[model samples]
Target: MGKFIDLTAADGFVFPAYVAEPAGKPKAAVVVLQEIFGVNSHIQQVTDRFAAQGYLAVAPATFHRVKPGVDMGYDEAGMKEGIALKAAVNGLPAPGVLTDIQAAIDHAAKASGGKVGIIGFCWGGFLAWRAACLLKGLSAAVPYYGGGMTAPAEIALQPKCPVLAHFSDRDH
Candidate 1:
């Protein structure tokens, strides 16, 4: 019931993205990065929330790099497949994902008429932080419960925009 759109990365990799537009002229744009679940219902709802806040929101399907349609739930089989995909993605350098994020950023910028922000959950949370670093045009970022970020000292220095990161001590 939401809007679906397409984006082509610098290397000619095309993928689908979920987008939500604000009522009037957008005050800003937000790139909503999904959890490992892909752009499911929850992710779509979250993007809609950003749209309600007067920001054009978009959530790109990051898994398209590994497979054209890779969405998984938290069930046992889904967990297994998600883990496998994560392992395969580890072989790809960070720059590769960064390229995809850049594509999303560009799309949002054009769609929102310039100003942009980013937000993400779980695995996408780490990506939001990375986008804050790699995507220079972003105005802000919010990352929720991204694991393994603290261990990497390099990421601490790369974020170019204001970042608001939230983590649950009990969960992550």
Candidate 2:
């Protein structure tokens, strides 16, 4: 349902992205950010689901800078590894991952020739919110259980586009 494609960032960094296209014409475009585990099967399935809903979806490999081609499961060990990777990547700097995400957004806009939106889970959720505040040409954003967004500083950032965020009470 989806295929891996490459995208280049503003600084010439190249990374792979999984793109799922709708059968007919796409009504809109969406940039699907991956969880801490990278662009794994679940993320691909989510992208495919968006495609099925008449949107061209693209999930960029945000972890490519630190560890390329990471695809882990939903086990305890996977969670631990994902946490470590997220910490390492987060410590680097701002705009590092954001640049990659921008590449995805640009690709989606080019592919669909219409408004682009974003949706993300966990670590990706934080990114989705950040993108809403920082990136341009976005129609809307949806973030699911973004733990980082709980920070006061993150919440202070204003979004340029409309955002709908989801949080679970049990999540920490």
Candidate 3:
């Protein structure tokens, strides 16, 4: 089973991250980013899956900057709340939630003592893409149907590491 732990960012902001350690030694670490929702159960399960694959996994709570303890469902009400929360985070000054993701990556690398990568879905995917381009200490990045990733500005940004993006025809 995985448990929640605290990770401090470069700016001294602390946040909760769901971490799952492998049974044996970890081959690497994978930082899992949440969807539009917060670090909910599904994201935690993804972290567990990574651990099962012999990787250290960490999923940070991306919404903690605006609101603490945000766990919502997939219903319309949840979607509505998530969007508003995302906007609030986006509205924050530069390097808002990105700092939190960096913290997760930093922790994963140290705790696992190996290379680090990142994966994300939906809104998290967009962040993952940006992280690949802007963050440090990542070996690779995968963004599953990253929202707004195809925008002119986002597409123009060069990635610091290799990136594998997954998108469906419905994203357009």
Candidate 4:
């Protein structure tokens, strides 16, 4: 089973995060941002994959701020619920979700011996891109099918570090 840890954000809020470590020295620390679903099995599997690739991996439950312990599957109903939760949190002003993302990156760095990267899926994908912009120590960022990122002018500029974004035509 993957390891679980409690991470405290900058604002003194606590959240659950899944972590996976490689056998040898890590090439870098990777913070895995979850899909609309919380840090569920799929996200954990992805974290494990990063660990297998020689990176220390951590996937933070971003929605833990609004509602803790919200892990959901990839079903239609799950999608609706996840979307609702996303809307509630995403609608917040600047420095809201960014606060959580920064905290995740810092926590992973401390746990993984410093160097850090980020990756995100679906809604988390947008967060990944934004994290690259907001966080200072990021080495790289990968965002996949990040919905609703196209219109955010502030987060649309070139990232502070290297970033690779994957988008599906059907998602937009």
lDDT of 3: 0.93
Provide the global lDDT of candidate 2 against the true structure.
0.92
Name the runs in model 2 displaced over 4 angstroms: none
Model 3 worst lDDT run, 10 consecutive residues: 163-172
**Candidate 4 lDDT over residue span 94-152, tens digit each:** 67777878877887788788689899988899889888777777989999988766876
Ranking by TM-score: 3, 2, 4, 1
Clashing pairs in 4: none
Local accuracy of candidate 2 as per-residue lDDT tens digits, 18-93 = 9999999999999999888889999999999999999999999988888899999988888899999888888767
Q: In lDDT terms, which candidate is top?
A: 3
Q: Candidate 2 clashing pairs?
A: none
Shift of residue 51 alpha carbon in model 3, Å: 0.5
The parts of candidate 1 lying over 4 Å away from their true place are none
What C-alpha lDDT values do all the predictions have? 0.82, 0.92, 0.93, 0.85
Against the correct fold, how does model 1 do in TM-score? 0.90
Candidate 4: 10-residue stretch with minimal lDDT: 148-157
Backbone clashes (count) for model 1: 0
Model 1, span 17-117: residue lDDT tens: 99999888998899998877778788889999888988899999887788666766667787677667656665687677677789999999998897888
RMSD of 3: 1.3
Model 1 root-mean-square deviation: 1.8
Provide TM-scores for the models.
0.90, 0.97, 0.97, 0.92
